[model samples]
Target: MPFESIQGRGATRNAVPARFNLPERLVEGDWLDEVEALDGVSQRRTTITVERPKSILTRNSSPDIGFDRSINPYRGCEHGCIYCFARPTHAYHDLSPGVDFESRLFVKPDAAKLLHAALSRPGYDVAPIALGTNTDPYQPIEGRFRITRSVIELLTETGHPFTITTKSNRVLRDLDLIAPAAHRGLAAVAVSVTSLDPAISRTLEPRAPAGLKRIEAIRRLNDAGVPTLLAVAPIIPQITDHELERIVAAGAEAGARVAFYLPVRLPHEVAPLFRAWLDDHYPDRAAKVMATIQSMRGGKDNDPNFFTRMQGHGPWADLLRTRFAAATRKADLGTGRLKLRRDLFRAPEGRQMRLL
Candidate 1:
């Protein structure tokens, strides 16, 4: 693990993905706070770079994913969730999935323009375009850039249906617009509440909203007439899995219409990073936790097959699914997939020209 010792960030260690054929480096001691006192570790500050991509809509026909298209307003999330599957994407740019992924971020300022152009293209078809499917769209930089707001505004104006997933209450800032769109069957939201335990949340997802805050956000969204769901995502097997039922119960009590859960997944660089995190935070149970994860993932760190990837396999996976089902039923929260209307989608009219 070159550049592997940088500690105290979301990832305990990291290196450039081997696929790039780049040589990696190692630190003897305290390179950017590696192998130093916990308090001495440098704070990882976030830097957002603006990008003007040619397109904003990403299309995929994967059978496992509900939506056909999605828009990631940013690349490299600052939320710093250790288990994030999207972390490997940063490796494509010669960046470490460790500190770089959390400290360095990229945002699309012209996302609205590209989205409008794509929607207006000839032969464009309508489907609910998903947000926050990769990097969280509501990550803290959003407060300054407001890129997500522009996206929602464009969608609202065109009557296009969309689904947003987030762990931030920042989405509440757009409640006035979201409530209207949701009323017209054009918008929905899912708030990911990974753990109700403040300690676990602080370590696992340092920058995401606290669990109760997310639940409160769901309740508020529902009260405002937005269809809200609870996402108990990336459930750690030996760690947070036991909280599945409680998570569902809490969210349902808070007015979430439905609940969804996915067992922890360790894809590519995420596996090693996660193992290091386990060793750092839970040294005693690290081996057992990895063993249990491999068991659920069919003797591998992860199962990449489309159908099996989300829920996983084997006894642990089955038990989790059963527990989730039982909890959702007991709490009377719908487990059914949310289906947003695509018929309401229409291209926005051309931007009005300003007099010179």
Candidate 2:
């Protein structure tokens, strides 16, 4: 009945109170009036488990998305960004999108093997496979698992092209692999810097790398020849939207080659979670913010329309777009999309040490 809350976490409340396929409304709240909270309420600890999926690449047909194939080495994210569009996804596992989404992670340690097999398949098309599309591949768990690194190694060995999106400075750890790949026209990186303000960023995305750190990450990536791009995502209408020009200029100063922004998307369980967050952090502007979001979403919390979903269609959306365009223009930040080479792809051959 109340917001999903786990004291030290970013999400103020558990948006998905009940597990998927098991609605809480099915049972009366009075029946379980004595139900108490689970453990780790104040301080959540990370739990990593392995998942060996049958396939590694997930293909999508979304018109707004540039890439079709994506690789998610993990099922849940640890960054704990309250407004993460991927939060609702944790519900499929019958888990809370709030605390569980960040603390309980599902890793794919065998991702590299599966990817190698899939790539070796006959007639398999070669394209730039995106990583961290669903959940970040370089979350803190990565330090122990290194699955993302394995994926990169495999792609590099096979001469396949790929791109990665992350908010962590951890990408610098793999500069060795990424730089050479970039030189070979096989890799690019997108660094997500949500807000420049540390205080806002702390509440907006508690576990993600800070805005200045991420800007430095962009700098290091570009300096290492990785062709870094800045992603100022989920431009919350009244909250972080005002920082559009400042963010763009900051990215350009860090040597980012291109920059982009996306208006906040509240889909499925994310709406309630974000609403709870707004109430907790920006109580005064919560109603006004939601009002603007609804206006942009056609009087709803979300709009799943094809083109409208990416950038809503309305006066507010138009103004946001115009602002983004102006900011990018002023910063000289638009260089078009950097296309990775498909021609360089090479599948392994047998007897070449059995392609080992």
- Can you write out model 1's per-residue Cα lDDT over 213-259, one digit (the tens) per residue? 88899989999999998999989977898788888999999899988
The top-ranked prediction according to TM-score is 1
Shift of residue 75 alpha carbon in model 1, Å = 0.5
Error of 2 at 241 (Å): 0.8
Off by over 4 Å in 2: 1-5, 15-19, 23-42, 349-356
Local accuracy by lDDT, each model: 0.85, 0.85
